[model samples]
Target: MQRSFILLCGLLLALPLRAADPDGKFAVDGVGARSCAEFTSVLDKPEGRTAFANWSQGFLTAYNVFTDDTFDITPWQPQELVLAKMAVFCRANPDVVYINGLSALIRSLIPDRVIRDSPLIAVRHSGKSVFLYRSMLARLRGDLNAAGYDAGAPDAPFADGLIRALRAYQEDQGLVVSGLPDGQTLNALYP
Candidate 1:
């Protein structure tokens, strides 16, 4: 499964780049064409989960290639987080195709997409490290401040103040108060 996903990503990366066509129609392929109920039903099986994840990755890769000024649609998100989001969407809209849910997810992620390459920073908390783009951190700081969390300077490195603010924000959002800018935290903050 991992090998297939890697191969898909490689192939996607090698494709000729193109700009997004807002009105252009595209076909839904693979597990993406399945109904949301079918997608949700497959979540319990490992093979099913992997198939959906790979399809989602492939879609996102194509999105990166086609979308203007976008490198990654969800740079800070993990595979599990993406799947979780899909599950939520599927649960809410069981009659829709999985591709529709993916499209909606991509639309929600537009504001948080990485516009260009940026330095990847390893942020450590509780002996765990999460790699995040520098621009993501800056944007996160701005979001925190806008929400009255006051995460110090927007461009500053992760510090005690930022940790405190993240904790406060996480607590307020009813998320895990780990004081780390984890996938879920970032999703909640950005969303």
Candidate 2:
């Protein structure tokens, strides 16, 4: 299969005018996703266009993953509209990493521990990690106390996250390149 970025790039060129970001707060970074109108504008045919409409339902189903601040859309419907479009995109391109990245963005916004504890985060259904309710909080910053990750312990102060997430957070924060989520870094990330 083709790389998701190449598809995103082609999608940008293939799409119409408007802010491409789902947030519309920024330009299309090519790293995440563009807005719904932009994506829909490019649908020249009836089949794919119709498909776009059918899949929007998942956006609402999965909306819980995002943080609350995502509500800041100047015209809120656009983000929702794009998220709805993204649901269609997911059906067509389930393997797309950027889609997963966007999903990550959605969850990245929520803050409450109880909400984060919900199964929508990452339900490990089959393996050892099963029954696991991972949180964006651990992956976010400052909340890396891992309270949601390993319960019953006093937030052991253990550093959290997979290697990749830690690396991304480190690079984004201009922190020392330890590639680990320390309390200082976590606080900075969530802060």
- Best candidate according to lDDT: 1
User: For candidate 2, which ten residues in a row score worst on lDDT?
Assistant: 123-132
Off by over 4 Å in 2: 1-42, 62-75, 78-80, 83-102, 108-191
58-127 per-residue lDDT for model 2 (tens digits): 4433353333333321111234444444556554665564435355544443452234232323322123
Best by TM-score: 1
Clashes of each: 0, 14
Q: What lDDT score is found at residue 125 in candidate 2?
A: 16
The 10-residue segment with the lowest total lDDT in model 1: 17-26
Clashes of 1: 0
Model 1 lDDT tens row, 40-129: 998999999999999999999989977789989988888888999899999999999999899899999898899998999998888987
User: RMSD in Å for candidate 2, one decimal?
Assistant: 17.2
Local distance difference test, each candidate: 0.89, 0.42
Q: Any runs in candidate 1 off by more than 4 Å, and if so which?
A: 1-25
Candidate 2, residue 115: Cα displacement in angstroms equals 9.0
Clashing pairs in 1: none
